[model samples]
Target: MASLQNAKNESHIPAELLIARVMQIHACICKLESLKPSKQVNSLFTHLVKLCTPPSSIDIKTLPQEVQEMRESLIVLCGRAEGLLELEFATFFAKTPQPLNNLNLFPYYGNYVKLANLEYRILDENGVVQPKKVAFVGSGPMPLTSIVMAKNHLKSTHFDNFDIDEAANDVARQIVSSDIEFEKRMKFVTCDIMQVKEKLGEYDCIFLAALVGMSKEDKVKIIKHIRKYMKDGGVLLVRSAKGARAFLYPVVEKHDLLDFELLSVFHPTNEVINSVVLVRKPLF
Candidate 1:
């Protein structure tokens, strides 16, 4: 384990070593949360916070692709740990039962509500009042953003959801299946964004969740990959944390966006993040 001082001097550490360490920390947190004792959970949560907090100068380009993908899981796990500790919840899945009809994302309601507002603002500003096809990448268990869009923006048949977590994808599929119209309209897949090879040229808009972890290489490759498949004038909406939330959902810089044309940046009204809208510049 690197000392806090050693963390500050990250140049000495190998990228693969760091990646392995981070991935192990992520897996450990996932397992530890399932144990009964609250004290044990708190102790693991504290240790994880230290392990996952990267040094400001840490070069993301050096990390492995798998580690980059697991970053968001760590962030969300850390956030859930904090919330769980505060609420005195015994285990990770200690939340109150949800009614089948209401897909309320309790703790995460604020995040999705803010995203819904930002989506509308972007659509209005870009004169895309009604996007024909929309994709939600890294959609979690509830897929609240897709739910909101189905109610307000996209037709049920025009939505596609993707996530790397099979369990999450299953839950999201189940939720979408609960509504006949949504079941007919939505397609949910369990896959990494970087590995998708199917034709996606029909989707005019794509939403990247705040926790969609991507290293510099991962970002570039996926952007290029999606660029090839997305409609010529497609818009990619990337949600990232700003200010102090960078400890978890790190800020996504302009350089990381690579060759895409940046359209606008929108700050959330009730959250600690900002959203970037990027457009596919027309081909010559």
Candidate 2:
């Protein structure tokens, strides 16, 4: 019995070690709405790893001063070796979901996986209800989680969908059309998000998604363009690619966004950078 237990522990002593440990930590956190002191302090070393994977870093100067401050604090809180590993773990758990017996990732990627926003939960503190004009800015095989979330969470008027890759748009169109329930609510635009550039600032919500590692200039242009379209006080949500590089491409100068506040930082189980970073446009 003892030998078998040791063997099980030893099996996880490789590249997947940190991922396994983070899963343990996540399980622990799930039991408590807020982790106790022991959990928080001990979380630093739980996902110990043997080697580094992603061998790159970016100039921190581009981050917002506050994000920079938080980065420094996180680094100090977690020592060099462990900090990197924890980030690996964070990247892992934040992106990928725990796998099932029959399912592993589609491979060919690393760092973090992404969750479909369909699994996302929205909250309301005030009683006022408003339906929104929602925009989904990608076309891919990823299921319609964001649209589902939009339909349920936001009082949605219509779903405006676009994809740069026409084939990808076709895939989205098929999946949405087959859903039967969501068919009438969605309109797929097989073109650049900029096609309806004039409507940028008019949408009640916007969803950008999982295309990581694209050209830096393109990311900047997209963010700048979206800033003009996303409605004031509307939600700006992103589902970045899984296991992508450290920052969202080129870190398009801060405040280039019309956002006022961040709603949540939702990191899911690892796969792709399937994270949901929800922001609200400023009322200015």
Best by the lDDT measure: 1
Q: What's the TM-score of each model vs. the native?
A: 0.65, 0.50
Model 1 worst lDDT window (10 residues): 86-95
RMSD to the hidden true structure, all candidates: 8.0, 13.8
lDDT of 2 by residue, 210-276 (tens): 4521444566567657766677777766653222122222232334343446665554433332445
After TM-score superposition, the amount by which residue 12's alpha carbon in candidate 2 deviates from its true location, in angstroms, is: 9.4
Count of clashes in candidate 1: 2
Q: Write the per-residue lDDT of candidate 1 for residues 1-284, one digit (tens) a residue.
A: 45444544443456466566566656766777263336666555444444434333345545556755677566667645543332332122223343234544254556566678677677668766677778888776667778777776655337889878776666666556656777777888888887775646767788776656534445556667777777766777877544323435645777766677777776443432444555654543
Counting clashing residue pairs in each candidate, in order, gives 2, 25
Give the poorly placed runs of model 1, Cα more than 4 Å off. 1-100, 155-157, 272-274
